[model samples]
Target: MAEVAILGGGCFWCTEAVYLEVKGVTKVESGYTGGAQPNPTYEQVCTGETGHAEVVRLEFDPAQISYRDLLVIFFTIHDPTTLNRQGNDVGTQYRSVIFYETPEQEATARQVIAEMAHVWDAPIVTELAPAAPFYKAEDYHQNYFAQHPLQGYCAFVVAPKVAKFRKTYADKLKT
Candidate 1:
């Protein structure tokens, strides 16, 4: 059976690019969640007034890759210790968060955070909350990295994260 995991590690472009390469990840959509707005535009979310975090909603086969594995990859690819920021991107919309879809998912998120804490020098500031209504990002943001690899942000920011993911999870890459 397939399961969904809504995670926000930073810019959805970077996270989406990383998950798209994972073996069991069947689909990855860049979107907005943990917000108050009904349907927010990129500009609104950017203003940080929408209270949304740019997130990636992943559809994956759990039998092939456990949620724990996904969480591990997520934690590795971004800095969870920093609040409302990821490298050059800084704002509430870029906050680190995990919006769990179920109680089991919530438990796993907590466990993963606890285990991953030892690896980070600072306390993990990643928020764990019940999954909220996901507002799919506009067409342009869907596959930003793949569609615009040569774009400055994609080339400089997203590419490095994807490279690290490939190097660290070589065996898990889709063949």
Candidate 2:
């Protein structure tokens, strides 16, 4: 047992898929957070006005995987340099964010962002916010890619993201 972390890189489905493959990750729940509304539906969230970014909350063992490692995979899998967008998905709801579960997590997130700034040319726009009420997304959103890899969005978007994660973070993955 360790700590929990919440991150939004774009679609929760994609983030959930990648984290689930990590060895220390005990659970990954697709959910909504950083929003004005409470328990917003998926339809409401996609509108980009819910104030909530689609996020995946992960419960993991720190002894096996560090939050720092998770951030590395996160930055690699998606464009944190981009503001309010991941490829075609555009909106504040798609912005890169890390909702920290503790003070230590918050501090670590800030430190990682600073280090990444030198690693990448563009500035990282990832927000380090305190963890809020996490509203679990509909059941249909869970394990989306694993269950529906043949779906168009899963093929075009999630497949590449997962492959990139597997390729770039091979040593960190759960084999």
lDDT of 1 at 56: 99
Off by over 4 Å in 2: none
lDDT of 1 at 116: 98
lDDT of each: 0.97, 0.91
* RMSD to truth, every model: 0.6, 0.9
- For all predicted structures, in order, the TM-scores are 0.99, 0.97
Q: Which lDDT tens digits does candidate 2 get at residues 56-169?
A: 999889999999988878888888899999988999889999999888988888988998898888999998899999999999999999999999999999999999988888
Residue 161, candidate 2: alpha-carbon lDDT: 90
Model 2 residue-pair collision total: 0
Question: Per-residue lDDT tens digits of candidate 1, residues 117-175?
Answer: 99999999999999999999999998889889999999999999999999999999999
